[model samples]
Target: MSNSANHIISVSDLKKIYIRGSEHIHAVDGITLDVNQGDYTAFVGPSGSGKTTLLHLLGCLDNPSAGVLTVEGKAVYDKGKFMNERELTKLRRDLFGYVFQKFYLIPTLTVKENILLPFAFYRKAEADKTADRLADLLGLSHRLSHLPKELSGGEMQRVAIARALINKPRILLADEPTGNLDSKRSEEISDIFCKLNREEGLTIILVTHNHALAESAGKMVELKDGKLI
Candidate 1:
């Protein structure tokens, strides 16, 4: 299959199965999807509907048991052509940013430190200017020196967002990013995603159960029982 620059991710007949004793649970079955560059797509599903599993697979956090999965026109997982752990790590670090329901920031680190953690991991020089710019955009410039404990829930989530973007990833995968926030904070987070998508042309794939939040995206896909409906 040919890969297009506009298609950041493409998958066909993707399947992820887990065997528990004699039971075979198909977390994701026969999912064919394409995520275009700069596209904001949301996946909605009930609990146990394989939304998270699908996200994980797309993010290269997990391997599929069967199917073709490609990122940036390169096949990352296809039968015997799976990427190794180190390559997967590099792919995730350089190409993808992740945000989750919990703002997984280090409690002891200041906002600036937390945001720069990815640089430290990659042993790359700190991009203070970029960090500051992202902080300003996320409304966290004033909170740079503050620790996670001192920030409000919304502020913490913003910090998480900044940290995720520190690597300047092409794709941002958010799984229930607004799940822990109040309605107002949730809206704020949703607005941030939209703003980033519009201003920076960031490709975003969000998995959310909230109809309002899902509708904010340019595309909405529903998954039920490991299949798109």
Candidate 2:
């Protein structure tokens, strides 16, 4: 702990490999990383080098094959057993916010509805006034009523960011968040992450191929050949 009592996430000797046809292919080899609270960090590497695999492990979308992962200081994998599926789901809902390369908003739902989706499932009444604020902050106030199809790519991604924020997660795990966008658009998303890191103190773990994005972050880590090389 770096003098801040709140390290949003931590990984210890993490490993994830695939066993197929009696062969082992390491997607993520032994690696350890720590993301302190309020960090704006970037992970850069080639595909299959374990950037996305590590992000998935951090997001709790997938568990590591062998290692310890502690998010908000709670063990993600322990005693040879990962969190139960039910526990993982609840943990993801309560502590983690995810922004994927492809915006995963519900097409039929309005932007506002999409932002408040998780609240409907887990919490009774919506508390996404923060989502609206985020929309406005991300310059999407005008697109709230529009369905996803009516919005531009950047607009849809901004909505996805807002949806991720609705849960008020301590950690935001963004995987190639700007992967599908042009250079200028990608910077806009990076700017948002920087702003959140500065103003709201949200910890961000972003995986990207863009050097400019990496430059903007406070810390940068690179992975190669399934290891932090």
> Best by lDDT, which number?
1
Regions of candidate 1 where Cα sits further than 4 Å from its true position:
1-3, 120-126
The whole-model lDDT of each prediction reads 0.91, 0.84
TM-score top scorer? 1
Worst 10 residues of 1 by lDDT: 118-127
TM-score of each: 0.94, 0.92
Q: Please, what are the lDDT tens digits per residue for candidate 2 over residues 136-170?
A: 88898888899999988878888899888887887
Candidate 2's displacement at residue 50, Å, is 0.5
Instruction: Quote the positional error of residue 125 for candidate 2 in Å.
Output: 6.7
- Tens digit per residue, CA lDDT, model 1, 1-229: 5346679999999999989999999999999999999999999989999999999999999889999999998899997579777888789989999999999999999999998877644335447877899999999999999999999999999999998998889999999998989889988899999999999999999999777799999999899999999
Q: Give the local distance difference test score of model 2.
A: 0.84
TM-score of predicted structure 1: 0.94
